[model samples]
Target: MRRNHLIALATLGSAALLLGAWGFQYLGYAPCKMCLWQRWPHGAAVLFGVAAMAAPVAILTLAGALAAATTGAIGVYHTGVERGWWEGPSSCSSGDITGMSTDDLFNQIMAAPLVRCDEVAWQLLGLSMASWNALISFALVAIWLAAYRKSAP
Candidate 1:
């Protein structure tokens, strides 16, 4: 595909991501801390996409690729945490409160988010949303990288 098409796709991806977040919120699915972490790179990708369209340079495309890859990597890590392959942060992950005082427990519970990073709140075709996000963002990274390579002089 052409460079312009790649840029357009990246822009569309950002819009899609934003829409999905909104949909989830509307559906009463509040994002956990880690879920919120995944939004930064998407924002960067969208900005890079605009830059790619305006300048169409290798550096901008590379930035876009990096942004997408960063988010994809985060998604992969989050997927691992969800699958219990590795541990997530205690703040987002569940822990024992057997010894804590009532006040402490209450404070912890109140501060804790509704969504747990280790829990698979939603899934599709046996894959969690993070896995799907990783796959899609990785593809977007490839597209951005390809656009950069094609633009090389």
Candidate 2:
């Protein structure tokens, strides 16, 4: 794997992630907080890929790999949150509401996000988007690592 190859792979992965999100949105599937959380690192990976393409540098490829890995880790955490293996953030998931006025409750309900990070809106072959992202992003990370290894002096 060369720098250009790694860069291309990273870019393609970012494009795929973006397109997948857009497709889900287009189909009326809104992203939860965790889903939104998973996208930033992919965006960074894409940018790093672009930089690598522009300069064909080993550092940029490694950066892209790091970004991919970050997103993949987040995706794994998200999958756990969805599967009830762990708890998600209070901003995305339900939490204890022992003390709250009716107005506060109403406001919370009204301001609450449409999507719940703890629930899977879609899945295929028992894999949700987060799982898919983990698999794909991890593969991208491997390509990047291989590129780095092969380019080592």
Candidate 3:
């Protein structure tokens, strides 16, 4: 396939994933902070793909790859959080309240976000959406790499 087609495919892949996420959101799955963070790079990659098509620059493809990597990395982190491999950000993750006053505990409860980043909202074949995003975004990274190699002189 041509470099432009490869770039477009990679870009569209991100777009499709974003749309799917939105679809899930519309279905009443509110995205947590981490989930929202994972979407940003995909958005950037879609734009980078358009820029690559217009300029056909190897650097743009490289940037797209970086964008993909960023999202992929975040997905991995999110998956780890979901699996309890590690704690997520305090703003979204449930923290211990072992030594809080009644008022403090109440305040924490009131301030807590509706969506907890450490919990899996949905999963398929034993994998959460974040895991799937990581896998697919990594594939996009390879596509971006191929585009870069093809366009490079």
Specify the highest-lDDT model's number.
3
Where does candidate 1 clash, by residue pair?
none
Which lDDT tens digits does candidate 1 get at residues 35-100? 778888898899988988998688998899898899889999999999999988879987667789
Candidate 3 ranges with C-alpha deviation above 4 Å = none
Clashing pairs in 3: none
Misplaced by over 4 Å in model 2 are: 98-107
How displaced is residue 13 in candidate 1, in Å? 1.9
lDDT sort, best first: 3, 2, 1
Which residue runs does candidate 1 get wrong by more than 4 Å?
96-107
lDDT of each: 0.85, 0.85, 0.96
Query: 1 or 3, which is superior by TM-score?
Result: 3
